[model samples]
Target: MQRFQGSPRSVLSTLLLVLVMGLLLYPGLKNIAVYLFSAITGNYISGTHSVVFLSCPNEQVGKVIARTIVEKKLAACVSILPKVFSIYNWDSEITETTEVLMVLKTRTSKIHRLTEFISGSRVE
Candidate 1:
């Protein structure tokens, strides 16, 4: 039986060919390929997007905050999660409570305004 031998350069070329073929054949790999390409080329897909997380005392408060931010255009979208069990230290004591979580998606340029609005809406 004859054995086949390949040079390192040929092996690398074969591997690269396989990788390109795999990327082309698999649709799900498109995102990964784009990300790797971006990293290698230093050509990032740019957007000034930001995600902010806020915890509210209850669903009503969460809804109010969400509606206000969206209405004011401070956030493009707000996702409200109704039940989040949080444990934290307040006033040197441990506190446990069920809270609503708000995830706000907005432009980084509006983060300052969004923060100001949320802080001003806090209940004493």
Candidate 2:
């Protein structure tokens, strides 16, 4: 009975420690995740009223993604820049490529949902 009581107290202490660690890490982890997502996708959503910059492989994908976003009411407006040069590192290689730029205008609150929609759109 004494050994079992000690085990329960130790288990409770471990659980409390885990809880505290989780609470401490959660906000920072969230920020890091947002930063990484923005860095990787280039959807650099900033400010209260936000603009997200996304690059599509071509005019067609750009149009499709832009139009679909607007139609779904995720963005008030989306403008497609016909041709843009993008230079970035991928797969440990620096590559320069031509792509269409899609400018998305929406409130900051909509950014997460908009990102989710784009993620499922399969345009990449």
Candidate 3:
């Protein structure tokens, strides 16, 4: 049979280990607050509230815009609807053509950033 040793030093070491583990396992205060709020309200965070509609000359450009939006987190989602028929007057001439449409949903705070990204993207 093996004999166990119970000493003050051993007890102190076990308590220190438990304290360290508790500190390590403790969740962040902000995260705990968010979790508690969501738990009580039964609603998860739905960040940002805005939607932007843009048109690009081609499907390729539309995809580029969409990719940039998602990569930058400027928008949560982008819906690309391509080959849209449109008629508009330009230079005193009525023009009918097909274009790609990009509908982006993002935070209102990120609208300017989204605009900059779209404007700077590969579009003509």
lDDT of 3 at 78: 93
Each model's lDDT:
0.84, 0.85, 0.80
Query: In model 3, which regions exceed 4 Å deviation?
Result: 1-48
Higher lDDT: candidate 2 or 3? 2
How does candidate 3 score on lDDT? 0.80
Candidate 2 pairs with clashing backbones: none
By TM-score: ranked, best first:
1, 2, 3
- For model 2, the stretches where C-alpha displacement exceeds 4 angstroms are 1-47
Q: Write the per-residue lDDT of candidate 2 for residues 10-84, one digit (tens) a residue.
A: 999999999999999998898778877876987755643688998889999888888889989999999899779
Clashes per prediction? 0, 0, 0
lDDT of 1 by residue, 30-98 (tens): 656766676688764554468899999998878877897899999989999988999999999999999
Clashes of 2: 0
| Candidates' RMSD to native | 11.2, 10.3, 11.1
Model 1 TM-score is 0.61
**Candidate 3 at residue 93, lDDT?**
100
Name the 10 consecutive residues with the lowest summed lDDT in model 3: 42-51
**Deviation of model 2 at 22, angstroms:** 28
Pick the lDDT winner: 2
Report the number of the highest-TM-score candidate.
1
